[model samples]
Target chain A: MSEVQLTSDLIQWKDGAADWEEAIRVSAAPLLQQGNIAESYIDAMVENIRTLGPYILIAPNVALPHARPEMGVSEAGIALTVFNEDVAFPAGHDNKTQTARIFICLAAVDSDSHLSLLQGISQWIDNSELLNRLLEASSKDEVKDLINQYS
Target chain B: MKILCVCGMGFGSSLMLKMTADKVIKKKGLKATVEATDIGTAGSTPVDLILTNNEFASQLKGGKSEVRAVVNVASEEEVEKAINDFLESQ
Candidate 1:
């Protein structure tokens, strides 16, 4: 398969979420509307964190929320939601909660495809300065440009 | 050395850990076979260390393998430290 670059329409900027579940819902809303993923995928993403803890926060202030493709993924895509204030996920390390300002919801066609999406996110996260800039970015185009520069 | 990157469903975060492990291990000029698997399979497979986030580490304990609860899956520094720390003890 070829590399996937996230489109600008799939990106959204928000102020904050009431909680983590809402954050996942807010992050995945674009994918659901695009028919890239089913609503069940959103529920599954939230369920994973509820059961397995906040494993999605791969880097500081960043998260890649995802579920098994078999659950409800129709197409391989990523939806990004940048929050002004960080949203917290439950049961993180040291009995404290994990929070993130950037939430990238991943929908892979199969088990094998998530790695590609993972590869893309890894580059953006590898540079903490870029990630911090992402949080500071003023517009969706800026966010897309920054991500495009790396992934 | 064999390293198993185990997660709840072996789909999301485990893959990231596997990627970092593969890169860090290769950079260190070490020979190792690393795989990402679900929790059920991880318990049955024998490996030197079972690497995962801190939350899943407790459930993966009491088994044959030693569990290292990693704080950051995408950090090369964290992963390299985990790998070197594990290799030195062996």
Candidate 2:
């Protein structure tokens, strides 16, 4: 799938919420509202952060938070976010070190699709230049444009 | 062939790896079934191979099937490479 197929307007972030939970909540809230995910799914994902720390902080500026599809997923897509300010996952070794400005929460039907999407995402995250550009993105249009370039 | 991919929660990363595997396998014209299992249910799945990331691969119980640890938690290339490496060795 192309970047357009993977993202939507819901993934954009406007405010820089100080609390990491709030940042995640803001990023994923829209998808939840549109019935893309069960309400509990959002809670489960946020709880992972609270409990496991920022283990999903896979790279320098990006964080991917997701739960099982069984939690709630009717479709296959990705929710994107750009945090206005850095937010920290306290307990991680990268604790306070890896603050994500870009968040991509994936929702898929099963393991196979989830894996493919994550792999697509990994290809984007693995690129140092693209990641930096994602962080620097000031608007949703810019973010989408950047992702379009890569995806 | 049946492939079982496991992770800590069988939720996020594990599922992602499974998707990539299925895609690659399908692309290569291999008929296979792939599922993601958490470490909790790894014993229940009937799979010929196990694909997992860094820390999670180490947790599997000794069994008759083969196991591979893909380099990154989420790299299709790594997963493909691992599978190719396994196939070559076999």
Candidate 3:
């Protein structure tokens, strides 16, 4: 299977977001514009969190927001949005707070296509240095370069 | 052993956790099969163990297989430790 590339058009570097829901919407905006996903997909993502809790905060500083393809996915795509400030999600079952500054919204048509994409994303999330660079990146090109370098 | 990695959507977080768990299982030389599925399907599927985050883990309470709650699904270190601890207990 071919791996999906993180194009510059899908990367957004901004000061921050108002809340987790807005963060997901802002991150998913690129995918919406690219026609890979519809607006309902974004709502589904937020609703999934509401129903299932903040399990999307997969790591210390990264959140992978996604919903079922049947929700409203047109094509398989990934969007990255970095925030200068932290966005908090609901407390976990243990009552521990979870926060993230980087939101990566995933729009997958099926389970098969997302494996390679998750592999690439896991590489970045595992690397502290690379993740730091990505969080601090100022431009889309810089973010794309980092993704290419690590992915 | 059959291990199921579960998340709300099945396509996103669970898949990521499965990938990380696969690496940890292989590196640790554990003899277990890992699969990813949605929370809804996970309840019906028969598996030896279930790996998921805290929220989903709670939903699986009183289920057939043992449920493991991973604090950080994205961290290989955390995943490796959780799998290893479970395997050692078995």
Candidate 4:
């Protein structure tokens, strides 16, 4: 798997965002700018979460956001980000919810490669310290540092 | 036997979990065919056991399975234990 660096527009959010919607807006900017994913990808995934709470909390504090590729993924790629403060996805399995400080947005060209990337990313999220670093990173360089360390 | 790994957007952790399942099962000398799919396509196929990270499970509306378990797939021990436990139960 190859690593993609987060650029300026990608790191759109600061330390605070009132809700998940706003957060997704900022988080989706970079990938959308790169033409990796269609504009609708973010809205679709965010809508799923808004309706389902944190159903996709794959690991402890990290949540990987996604929607159907048909929703509009023109390319096979991912845009990642670390959130400063913990954000909640309200309802989820077990009363157990997620802080969701890290976001891995996946856009794939086909089903098979999509699954491959998903597996790679899940393994990546398993690392607690790595997840922490993603959440704590201040700039794209720092995000790149964390990605290099793990990916 | 068949094992299905699921994930969101049909990508991400589920694919990772599929690789993990392959490695662990191979090491354990178990005979099984592992297939990973996005949850949206889950109903389109047949599976014996379903493995997935959190998000994909939610999208799995209803499908065929003797067992359906949702684990982080992030924890090796957890994955191993779940696999062992499933094997024994079967």
Best prediction by DockQ: 3
Candidate 3 lDDT for residue B39 = 84
List DockQ, one per candidate, in order.
0.59, 0.16, 0.64, 0.43
| C-alpha lDDT values of all predictions | 0.83, 0.70, 0.84, 0.68
lDDT: worst 10-residue window of model 2 chain B: B53-62
Clashes of each: 0, 7, 0, 7
Per residue, candidate 4 scores C-alpha lDDT tens digits across B16-85 of 6777788878888889988867656776787777787554454553556644455566676666776787
Q: Under CAPRI classification, how is model 4 graded?
A: acceptable
Place model 1 in a CAPRI quality band.
Answer: medium
TM-score for chain A in each prediction: 0.91, 0.88, 0.92, 0.82
Order the candidate numbers by lDDT, best to worst. 3, 1, 2, 4
> How many clashing residue pairs are found in candidate 2?
7
What clash pairs does model 4 have? A56-B55, A118-B12, A118-B13, A119-B12, A119-B15, A119-B16, B10-B38
- Candidate 1 per-residue lDDT, tens place, B1-90, comes to 899998777877788889998999889989999999877688899899888977678778878898887766778888899888888888
Q: Which tens-of-lDDT digit does each residue in A1-151 have in candidate 4? A: 4544434455433575677776666666677888878878888988877665565666776666777778888876666667777777675654665576776766767766666566667667677778766776887778776676676
Output the better candidate (2/3) by lDDT: 3
DockQ-based ranking: 3, 1, 4, 2
TM-score for predicted model 4 compared with the true structure: 0.79
**Which candidate would rank higher by DockQ, 2 or 3?**
3
Please give, for residues A1-151, the per-residue lDDT of candidate 1 as tens digits: 1365577779888889999999999999999999999988899989988877877876788888888888898899988889989898886545877789999888988877567877777766778888888899877778888777766
lDDT of 3 by residue, B30-88 (tens): 78888988888999997878989877888797888888888667788888777767777
Query: Residue-wise lDDT of candidate 2 within A1-151, one digit each (tens)?
Result: 4533654566585658768788777877777877788878888888866664555654456777777677778876778888767876564432234566778877777755555666677677657788788887888888778877877
